[model samples]
Target: MDSSSLLKEYPLNPVVWDEMCVQNEVRAPYHKVYEFLKQISTEDLTRKEEMARRLFMNQGITFTVYSSGEGIEKIFPFDVIPRIITAAEWDFIERGIKQRLKALNLFLKDIYHNQFILKDGVVPIEMIYSCPHFLREMHQLNVPHDIYVHIAGIDIIRDADGEFYVLEDNLRTPSGVSYMLENREITKRIFPDLLPQNNVRTVMQYPQLLYKNNPNGLLGVAGLMSAYRKGNVAIVNAPGNGVADDKAVYIHVPAMIKYYLNEEPILKNVPTYQLNNPDEQAYVFENMARMVIKKTNESGGYGMLIGSAATEKEMEDFKVAITANPREFIAQPIISLSSAPCYLNGKLQPRRIDLRPFALCGPDGIEIVPGGLTRVALREGSLVVNSSQGGGSKDTWILSK
Candidate 1:
């Protein structure tokens, strides 16, 4: 069988965009990859994927997933197929994300300083004040180079329309670039022939993109913040940025961009409803089965309720929780996140996935490593892609054109 026939054997979800092959047509950026894979045997391909998993585990590239009372450290799942983005597509994504982050950084500074946006009514003042990550102590404090968002993991997801939307902003200590770099390394070993002869545009800035393993978690947050304030060391993501990414605060980011940059957002936010609004709350509560509810401050895919997957008891419990503290929650129509082919269970399977590109805002400016982490929902038909939520990582490739 040819490449087309082999790949088409796996059914593509009708509602999601396939990153590699679309309706029997290989996308331009993935054309080379399709040809390359055509010559490889399925058994050999399976072997390589298994090898990749072992390599990740041996390198200690893992995240702990807790269940009941146990913390289990498992090697993050790796998909051998590269998710390719064309040069033009990447240019749009790169520019749009940099713009969004700039707007968010300005918003953070403004919120911490004069509260201009709030005073102007571009964003509700109560939204900021109610945010759990909003820190009053950072008011008037200066971040080195005036860049509050040193590192950001801006999650991008494609809906059924194949348009990318900024799913969420990871402003405070965004993890996963480690996996990005690791994925590239493993790819190097797995596809040495293709990468060497052709200089595929990969995440080349390794030194700057990778984050130090934070063994201490929040215990280190205080020390890092103090040193940051003192100018002793510039933290990658300046402290107190969590407020900007708070789910409730995220909905207003486009407004922040408009207010601060005076430019329309290049990337649109997923339509979100702040539970604090009585009308929005009523709508969300009435349509609980069609919405995905999340706590404004939650991360690592925690504190989320997938309406389609939730049990009735869980919905009742979550509805009561949201009702009890409406300001703490936000809801969005469950988006059909794009899918990618993953080598799992000894076969190529379609898995829901999202893109998280890491942005480094240094003294110079924002420099994004070509492709970031492509997190996959390892389970069948799942949307949650955090590694902690049984998700996996894939090497993302930005074609050289």
Candidate 2:
């Protein structure tokens, strides 16, 4: 039997299926992807996967999971489809991300030092006060570079019109950048033709850029604000950042902005209510069915309660827990997350997903990576995009044209 007959016999193996036949004649993007995959053999693809696994292991690129006991490191799941981004599209995304990061950094500084934005009524004081993430301990404290956000992964999603909008900001210890670099390497081996044909820009240099020229470099925030007499150089990613990234600490961001920057914030935060605030807590206690509650500092897909998905007993338990310690939780209205085409089983299906584009701050200016990690909720119709919760990732290729 030839390759076609072999494929008919073994339809479950993706490697065999892809190599056995010519894909349907599609348009530009899909045609391009299929053509590239056809050039590599099934055995070659397996070899590439092994190489990727070795590369990750040699580089010590692993994340710690707590439940498996402390110091249990695991490799992140790698996907073969390398998302491509064009130069022209990258230009727009880069500018937007930089502008947003700059404004947010300035906002954090101002909220901690002066109440200008709050006083001016651009953002309500109650919103800041009611945030579960607001860190009172950071008030009037000097961050070495006057920069609270050292690394940022701003989440964005494209709507039906194909326009992108900011969904949320991952300021503290944003993960998945490692996966971005590794994905590029894996794709290059599996589909070498995809790069030259698509004119994809190289993103391998990003990690090095992040390590060097940290915002806390010698020349500090003096240029942005003149209130501080001395500049201190400290890497914000010092030990204990895990504790700081908690959702409860988020409430203090606005206050951190006022107390440290002595200016007003330009960007707006999502409307939130702390379960601890007396009035807000009471309101949440009364209307548990209308809100999406989240634990202050949990990462991945854990510790979340979608009002529509909770049982009566669970809702009652949550109310009791909030009454005991409201500071540990926050609530927001559900925003419909975006979706994209994904290859599931054997067909293309719509999967709910989100994007996380990275931003860097330096004396010259801010740099935002044009391409982001497009994460999909692997389970059918699921909205959670975290890799820890049976989710998969795709490459985001920004169109050059």
Candidate 3:
């Protein structure tokens, strides 16, 4: 391919891991996709992108954004190129998520009952007591099957060294599975032959997999608490799921895995600092610009500050907020997320991306659909990948081989 080809315009940064390329050579997993793109004209690729948008609109594949109590509906943005993953990589991710979920479920059961981890000082008692999501009412309450997290969306990102790290665990009513399914359908409409040629595994079975564990007749929406107490209705994400959702509690997941399962973590967590600690707070304050500060109990990309992207005034204001309620915040050094080629404005550009593989924990065991929602930071040099933050998504292809 010449320098003007779609593949050539994508500039690889030495510090950022490129998913499809390494030093101008295409990676093995993305070799087919890279060759296919080289044969397509830029105009043809642009048309495919446009076709994806139209299909999304027609199919009502969208999410609503709420601002100032008003909800604004917008079509979910999708990139034309699909993100591809090798079989080995998918196996690694699948095993890691299942192991993490097992530990988290065990932690929830222990936290609300025996408090063994707390007594053993694996996790602090004060941290649990101060967390808003720690439900006192759930203490000692029995749940069916001992499964606290049924559906989990684990946010994972590849760092500069191309190593996968768990960003956070979303145990409370995790969304975006629909987006994962829809992205695949859109890709089928846009690139009909590519999927079969690549031997990409199917994510179409996700809905059926979920139905396999569906609750048997539902009680009336009213008196849910009463029904739940009597075991008449089992919640999908059992009550007190938010306890695991707390970012403060997230700092202890690796330890939880070892404590409950007696195994070291298969997936590592991003190095997180607890702002409630005096020494850690002092360190974060001094190097604020190199970190990303987040509210412990908040989600949807809200209540966060990317210190590197913040203005001086914004950083100062965030510091004041962190000081006032140190327990509500945690900080991590900004990760240089992996990037993939994306077709933008008739040119291929590199965009940062993350993967959120949906894991379904059922009575039988955990089943992770091979492919996932590959969320991309569409804007140039942007790091945030939440849809609410101007992010787009592309279909993820998990090769069968």
Q: How far is candidate 3 from the true structure (C-alpha RMSD, Å)?
A: 1.4
Candidate 3 to truth, TM: 0.97
Worst window of 10 by summed lDDT in candidate 2: 13-22
Measured over all alpha carbons after superposition, the RMSD of each candidate to the real structure, in angstroms, is: 3.1, 7.7, 1.4
Full ranking by lDDT: 3, 1, 2
lDDT of each: 0.83, 0.60, 0.90
By TM-score, how accurate is candidate 1? 0.93
What is the per-residue lDDT of model 2 for residues 1-401, given as tens digits with 9 covering 90 to 100? Answer: 13343224332322111211223223354456655444555566556656766866787766666654576667765444444444654675676666656656766666676857778776667656655556565566566655667678877654443455554567767888877776676667655667778766666768767766473343334543333223335554322233334565445445444554554433334457877678988777677777778877666767778777789999888888777767678887654455544544433344666778877776556666656687877776576777766677766665555
| Residue 63 error, candidate 1, Å | 1.2
- Per-residue lDDT tens digits for candidate 1, residues 1-401, read 15666676778877788887688777766666777778888888888888898898889987887754699888788889877777888898999899998898888888899998989888998888877778888999987667888778899998899888999998887888788889999999988887654457868675634343211223355567676667666655666788888898889888888888999999999999988789998898889899999988788888999998999999999989988999888999999998887777666788898999988776566888888999999899889998888888888887676
Clashing pairs in 1: none
Residue 165 alpha-carbon offset, candidate 3, angstroms: 0.2
lDDT score for candidate 2 against the true structure: 0.60
lDDT of 3 by residue, 266-337 (tens): 999999999989999999999999999999998878999998999999999989999999999999999999
Stretches of candidate 3 off by over 4 Å are 1-4, 217-220
Task: Give lDDT: candidate 2, residue 244.
Answer: 31
Q: Per-residue error at 1 for model 1, in Å? A: 6.8
